[model samples]
Target: MERIITVRAEINLFDGSRSGKTTGYKSGIRPNHFFEGQTSSIAGDIQFEGQDELALGGKCFAIVRFLYPEWFPPVVPGITWRLHEGLRHVGDGRVLEVHSGR
Candidate 1:
């Protein structure tokens, strides 16, 4: 069974990312979540605050939904994570709240 989870976090996209120059990113973007020592990407969706486009490279609070939250290590406040596209590290974030989980 899929136990999806929602988490609120403050994210910052790397200024060097390919899409980093884009003015804004829409919600519902599927970015891989990578935590410490993790070698694989955990599928997740990002819902930016206000459900509107958000500027990259700036600290932005967002709600992320993990499709396989159980596959990840225990998520708690202050735990940092990285967002990736394939092998490229696009952004980074810190967990603020675990809204729901398995």
Candidate 2:
């Protein structure tokens, strides 16, 4: 069975101040910024351990993990940074397709 999971990338903005404040616009709240060029695709396998009906029907839950790049451009306040986008198969197994919400 094959499954495609689409995901949108977001950056969490936090204030560097010791007072634990969030940096954003006048609202003091930062919204999730979805960009057109900041998306990744990861492929992996889904293994079921039991005979549950949902598992058999390919409806079982899965958790996929991946590593982000060690180097990224410097972040600027009030600006969302999106570097790359598209689908690239990094491995072979079940397929998980991630798409960026622009």
TM-score between model 1 and native: 0.82
Q: Give the deviation of candidate 1 from the true structure as CA RMSD.
A: 2.4
- Least lDDT summed over 10 consecutive residues: which range in candidate 2? 83-92
Note the residue pairs that clash in candidate 1.
Answer: none
Say which candidate scores most in TM-score: 1
lDDT for each residue of candidate 2 in 1-102, tens digit (9 for 90 to 100): 223332322222222242133322221112222222455432322222232222111222222222223232222223333211132111112213333211
Off by over 4 Å in 2: 1-38, 52-58, 62-102
lDDT of 1 by residue, 1-102 (tens): 457878999888766456534455578888788888877767788888865766666668999988764556677888888887777677888889999883
Best candidate, lDDT: 1
Per-model CA lDDT versus the true structure: 0.77, 0.25
